[model samples]
Target: MTESALLVCPHCNAVNRVPSARLDEGPKCGKCHQLLFDGQPVELTATSFQKHIDKSDIPVMVDFWAPWCGPCKMMAPQFAQAAAQLEPKVRLAKVNTDTEQTLGEKFGIRSIPTLVLFRQGREIARQPGAMNTAEIVRWALSKISR
Candidate 1:
């Protein structure tokens, strides 16, 4: 059997050990049985953000954006494309600065469309602005080892 790695479920917040080979096989959470990767960015609330960043073993890329920001709207599709291509290896998330103001302030995000990359609960890199899918993937991959 292939070795399994610990993965924190985005749905039920359960820690599950899944075979590495099954990473792309639509693996479900052991406890809640929800599909692990839904191929979409996880919308993060203030409460869930801390838990997710601290518990997840994989690298997390969070897009800090607000509905009113035109740049953020334009960048949304690129972020989604990157998320879809980098599934099972990287976790993509989004935080609405308008709603989750506390998180935005805490992160010192003065600009919309800021991408923060976190690993092991600590932020490693941050970029403020819109980036194409290739640039997003390149930036993320540069920070993490494959």
Candidate 2:
């Protein structure tokens, strides 16, 4: 049998099929040939946010932040660290509330540092506030398998 997994291209919004066994090794996008997991949060717009949530087979954690939010800025480094540790297992994404207002409203995000977890296109959990690297990692790990 053929094993297939979903991967959302970070450079372009292309959904590519990746083999399950090759996920940890490193997977490249079929269209752009970019590494699927680059240890950075995927910058998501309104359109891409919806697409990624629906198309990604793995669990997604989205950081809802705004440019002017001080806490959001302070949490960036921690978020990046968590993303690096969780690579190839879970997808880390960021939604700028300043740009993606529609997506922010769609998720009922009232707080600037809200982190929403999505799996199979549905919201599984959400945490509101700026968390440290360990807290963020624990929260994300609680929702996904290693």
Candidate 3:
């Protein structure tokens, strides 16, 4: 039997069932008709955050950040670049802690630039700090296996 992956659409918050083997074939959301992988991180608010992590078969990497933090600002571009390279396989997302303080509290995020890797709604690994594009990519790739 062929297995399918459940992906939550970053565009319209719709859930899509994609064949595991065809994940890289540029699948479009059934409801929104938008490309699922757009080579950009999804800007997630607290309301939309739970569904993405819980429903997505692929790993979800979240950058917990606030706009006023220097390190978070510095890593924003690098995070975006990493998202461009890692998409379709992994869903990259960002949560502005300043706006989503409840999410920050729920996740126990004490730092401005924290990277959390989640698979099946469970956190697998976490890194707190700013990293360059290469580092971010490498770190995420390494953690996905766990």
Whose lDDT is greatest here? 3
Please, what is the whole-model Cα lDDT of each candidate in the order they appear? 0.89, 0.90, 0.93
Backbone clash pairs for candidate 2 read none
Q: Point out the higher-scoring one by TM-score: 1 or 2.
A: 2
What's the lDDT for residue 8 in model 3? 94
lDDT of 1 by residue, 1-146 (tens): 23876677888778788888888899999899998888788889998898778877778899999999999999999999999988788899999999999999999998889999998899999999999999999999998873
Which residues of candidate 1, in runs, are more than 4 Å off? Answer: 1-3
Report model 1's TM-score to 2 decimal places: 0.91
lDDT of 2 by residue, 1-146 (tens): 13878978988989998998888877899999989999999999977888889998888999999989999999999999999998877899999998889988888999989999998899998999999999999999987752
Clashes of 2: 0
lDDT tens readout by residue for model 3, 1-146: 13999999999999999998888899999999999999899999989999999999999999999989999999999999999999877899999999999999999999879999999999999999999999999999898865
Q: Can you rank all candidates by TM-score, best first?
A: 3, 2, 1
Assess the local accuracy of residue 14 in candidate 2 as a C-alpha lDDT between 0 and 100. Answer: 97
Model 3: colliding residue pairs: none
TM-score, candidate number 2? 0.95
TM-score of each: 0.91, 0.95, 0.96
